[model samples]
Target: MRERAVSGHPDRPGRTPGVTLPSVTERKGTTNESGVRAERQGTAGRLPALAHESPATAFGDYRAAFHSARLPMALLDGDGLIIAANPAFGELLGTDPGRLTSAAAADLADLGSDPRLWTAYREVLCGRSDRLRCTRRLKHPAGQTLWVEVGVEPLPGGERFLLTVADSSDRHDLLARVRHLQMHDPVTRLPNRALFFERLSSALEAASFEPSGTGRIGLCYLDLDGFKAVNDTLGHRVGDRLLSAVAQRLSRCAERTGGRGGDASRGHLVARLGGDEFALLVENSAGTDQVAELAQCALDALQQPFDLAGQRLSVSASIGVVERTAAGTTATGLMQAADTTLYWAKEDGKARWTLFDPERNAHRMTRQALSSTLRPAVDRGEFTLEYQPLVGLGNGRAEGVEALVRWRHPQFGTLAPNRFIALAEENGSIVELGRWVLEAACRQARAWQLERPAARPLFVSVNVAVRQVWDSDLVADVAGILAATELPPELLQLELTESAVMGSAGRPLQALQALSDMGVRIAIDDFGTGYSNLAYLSRLPVSVLKLDGTFVSGFRSQEHPNPADETIVEALVSLAHRLGLTVTAECVESAEQAARLRRIGCDTGQGWLYARPLPPERITALLDADGRTDDF
Candidate 1:
């Protein structure tokens, strides 16, 4: 086939027969011949007329341009069959121009491999679309992969299409190199955070859409334990070398676990997510066990010492493993869970692996929620006191009652002191909560005293946190509460844990002595459990010793009574008597335990044996029933 050329008709002045070429007067909408002449004169330099040339001469010039032009060009018939090809087009595919005739244009560059592009190519040939343009990867006969931009446009008469190809291999290679640098860590030479999250998101998306997938994803997030110490002692140069070595080992571990069935394509992705932190992502994880195995392998690998520049240093890592279904999962959520589990590993003493536990996480979240709401709860009056009776061992009369605080949390229901006391102390909110307890207990004790003006009044003992003394004016708080309630100072006993009062030489000791001098009693709570310093007891003005529950729990069974526990209790009680301090046994669950405590000369007892901590109404009922009831 010969190259097609544009020709003019003999009847028309300067237009082709089948092709319509609008005259300048028509295009500019100028009816006057003078205006048309002026418009044509303005564009005369940019547009040159070829209508005067013969058809044979125009054909010759077209054939020369097609054969010698640098741009790759081809002519395709309406059926997509290559009718003619230029030398540049032949060189682009590394073939002879003569051998390309009658070949499908889509088959030459493998453009038909993609259904969309193939359909678009056929659309242009059939005149359904004006043009089709896309980039395609083609293999040359010389064993080279070439990236080319393929463009198809309809020719005159719309029966044939002109196909052009532009080599874009250099641009593609440059972009790929830039992407590699952007998505990798400089020091570790591993994938950086950007690539890690990208792959994670893609894997989740694939798992969601692909039915043949495992439907699960996994991650092992870890960091070097005690890594900062190395960076502090040694210089960062050594630190960096150590991190690189750790990254290499982690990469090997990931590869080993990922290639389980001899498939390298199924391998995991190891990435350096900044500093000593690293992550290994499993695209199609089997289950938690698979992820855990990967974590264990990483831990074992890092347990070995790294030799960096002649300095041998031992290091370890803590790993958090998470594996679950890809449904309803997101990259951010997975990363958050992995981070929390990693913290748990470090908290569990480091150098170990921890799996994500929903229960444990929920507990932590509950603690955080409770901590944040503590001070507000106090202001909202969520806390109330429950009284546990302290009975005299000699007459079995209710001598006093220990005030245990309970939180009537609206959302969590009733919470005991064990749940939120430590949180309050840590946040320095215990001072306020402790003050509330003191005033409330004193007021309630005053109420009880008014109820029974004739009976011996029950003293109310309130537990004092160490921070309450350090963070607040305990002496003034107590004195004000006692004066306001008109309850005698002696009737309000303050209890401090043994640890808090053991080395009490500073403000704590001063506060205790000042409270003691004001005629208020001081009791050492949980005496036997902490710092059992019997000699140190003489220095403080503590008047009561509350033995811990462990000592009383041993005296439960009469036949198989713990002789050692009994001897210890008796010795301590005797010692307390000598020191002018009364002994109160705690956690007396049964009558047998209570009887044994009484026999041991325990001055007072507080436990379930007498009564569990009860509401004020129930205690009033007990007081109304009898002056001093044994049990409710």
Candidate 2:
């Protein structure tokens, strides 16, 4: 068939009026070297062709030249009428190509009133640009809408234009995949830290600026206690699986509270902050009591043991919570405050929840500064260990020396254990510091043995912080320090508080037993201050009980009056002797108190009366003054 040449429009007066050749669609990922494929018969046609059939006929050759033209194509008249289109257009829109008629520019692609697309098209139509590109939503009759990138351009004289639309289906799919990976944790597929913060920021803003709302947010920062043990004792694979299970359980916590409150927009979010630390963000929350309820909910959810790879693992968390308006607040402050509050939870004892208090936060800030400075202080030689001799009441000779920590701050002068031990434990520096103290004290004991060669070596007792035992490798660490110092374990004593020993159930007790079995002695320090289970005291392998300083401090009277206090001390001495444990009275500040303790048959005593705690050098001098040399 002889094709009529494509025509130009009246807008260009001097141009030839006949039809011009049909245009070819650009093909991607195709070898168009061959004259088009038979299947791509008529997908392209000249934009200004006024005769539809001729344009359609010419398009077949254009389509043959570009076989991979996947996007739909169309031609529009000066009035924006659908003049001619290819079969691909109908297939893409799920409509008949022949049935589409030209209408207003807005009517054709449903540009409607959205100026983003309309303005771009008008600019191209007025000959301001040769081409226009835009991303748009095309609503389908089947109720499915697609994201598309449409390119449109004007022909000469502005009589017609070419429109090409690419199905952004693949790009959209790829974006969805990328977004999922970006927002979710690959291990658990739970929303990660970035996404959680994004949501939290938005929630804070909404609560802050949204009118007529109370603007409250509840946050629960939870750290899984004993989680490190699972990783160290088992393996990381098991730990990873446990974290995944934890995420699932936490998700259930968020969902349990997410209910429609007559309006559908408010709820809570749960996210994993990092290893072993997770959080729940509740938006527009109630006050502290309600937040506490949420915490209780989470605790209840975590109460059940996790089944990870054929092993049943148990863990509990310490939660710190705060719920209030986001007014004048920042994301960083919120998280830092939450973390600080969590430290308090752990400090007060784990497996519990504590509400955030500004006063508590101030204390935390001070402690944090102290904790950071502790490591450097050791190198600066700021710490000194003081040994208060424990004298055997029967022989008037030293039986042991209790090593206590003291710091000589350049500005603050001498600061005792009360000032730094808790801070050190919080920051985990206590493990190393405690080891250093142990080694130093044991070496001092060896020195004391050398000086008093004729006398038996006095046992050296060192205090152990509970965190050092829980978080660090207690058994191996103690054993390593003993081996390193070449100090006999029999001469070292590990002193712990009564409360620390009470709740070990089975595990901590097993650990303590391990240390004791290796020949080290165990003593319950500050014995009567805590709820001392005397029933279990005998069962413990402890060798000594130092009565709390409070009991002895109150035992004295202004005159020779408190015989009742002396009688009570006598009863304790009898009770301890019956249990095969030596009882030592602490803070025996006066000769009168020392005489009373001795008269009561107390086995051994530690007090200022026996000579205040001194440095290792002083302790050595004292041993030498006793005038014996390695003669034991």
TM-score for each predicted model, relative to the true structure = 0.83, 0.49
lDDT of each: 0.81, 0.72
For model 1, how does the per-residue alpha-carbon lDDT over 548-622 read when each residue is reduced to its tens digit? 999888897988888999999999999999998899999888888888888879988887778889999877776
Cα lDDT for residue 148, model 1? 86
Model 1 CA lDDT for position 366: 97
RMSD of 1: 10.1
What C-alpha lDDT does candidate 1 achieve relative to the native structure?
0.81
- Residues 1-632 of candidate 2: C-alpha lDDT, one tens digit per residue: 12111212222223221112233333334222322222133333323223334555644656543324566877664434455566676566776655543323344454434545555555566666678776666666676767777778875445567777677977987997898788777776666788778878888888767877767778899999999999999999999998888877777767766632111135667677778888788777767777788788878777789988889988888999977778877788888888888888999998998899998677767666677789988888888888878877667677778899898877668889998998887787898788778878877787777667786677899999887787777888879877877778999999998888865666678878999999999888888778867788777788888888776775565475476667677787799899888898888777666677778788776776677777777766656555121121
Instruction: State the lDDT at 110 in candidate 2.
Output: 45
Off by over 4 Å in 2: 1-70, 73-91, 95-136, 151-164, 205-214, 231-241, 259-267, 287-290, 307-312, 370-632
Worst 10 residues of 2 by lDDT: 1-10
Error of 1 at 394 (Å): 1.4
